[model samples]
Target: METILEFISKHIEMFYLIILMIFVGIELIGHVPSVLHTPLMSGANAIHGVVIIGSIIVMGQAHEIISLILGFIAVIMGTLNVVGGFVVTDRMLEMFKKKK
Candidate 1:
């Protein structure tokens, strides 16, 4: 674990690059058409579900109160986002259905 932390500290530039890439990726996603947003959001929500799983794993391994609290918050927020995404996607699809 110490080795990992040392490596991260040594390669902090890589982390910065990754953060920049993430922001750029988010900006590019914003350029997607309105018609595509719902599907993309649903996909993102599925990814967030994976994030929740990771957070749960982290929570299980957490030894400190602060880490536990942060992990729990991550799980809760991810759940809310996923549920909200599904609701929005469903509503968007409903508009495309032929009305009786």
Candidate 2:
């Protein structure tokens, strides 16, 4: 408990920044028109693809157990995000196809 408090105190600014980003992201996303969602998600997918590669590199270089674990989790989450984004984008694109 003491260690957690110390850690939080040490990184208080980072925590605040993260909280601020979350709120800003929520507001920005909420205001995006539905027509823009596909393009936005494609951009996000590209970003997450980079994240997945970076996480894999981190996992390969990680010597500590905690670092390895966190890197693995990051890779998994990034992969999921990328795959889900592609799936959604594909479905969205399908809607534009004319009937057979």
Candidate 3:
């Protein structure tokens, strides 16, 4: 849509920063050993909670139906991701716990 295009144009710098960060994150993760992946993913899940909040804000402010629907879906997916990440992290950490 025209509005989306205009918004993206106006915030092009933000988009560039986001893209750059994505690549940087991927590169960093690529170098991490398998042992550290669980902790890293747990941290990412906390960060994704922020994404859910952002999506909620978008859903609240979205005037167009399509935008609202997309935002809602984003929130749902983010929630699922965060919850799953925490569960996996907990299971991984449990293996290291000493017997009582």
The global C-alpha lDDT for each of the candidates, from Candidate 1 onward, is: 0.81, 0.81, 0.83
- Report how far off residue 92 is in candidate 3 (Å): 1.0
Tens-digit lDDT track for model 3 on 20-85? 999998887888878877677786776667677788888889999899889989989878877877
Candidate 3, after superposition: displacement of residue 51 in Å?
A: 1.4
| Clashes per candidate (backbone, < 3 Å) | 0, 0, 0
- Residues 12-95 of candidate 2 have per-residue lDDT tens digits of 999999999989879878888788787677756755566778888888899998998899899898888778777777776677
Task: List candidate 1 stretches off by more than 4 Å.
Answer: 1-39, 42-48
Estimated TM-score for each candidate: 0.53, 0.53, 0.54
What lDDT is reached at residue 77 by model 2?
Answer: 89
Candidate 2, run of 10 with poorest lDDT: 42-51
What pairs collide in candidate 1?
none
What is the alpha-carbon lDDT of model 3 when measured against the actual structure? 0.83
User: Candidate 3 has which clashing residue pairs, if any?
Assistant: none
Candidate 3's TM-score reads 0.54
Q: What TM-score does structure 2 among the candidates reach?
A: 0.53
Q: Please state the error at residue 74 of candidate 1 in Å.
A: 0.5
By lDDT, who's the top model here? 3
Residue 63 error, candidate 3, Å:
2.6
Worst 10 residues of 3 by lDDT: 91-100
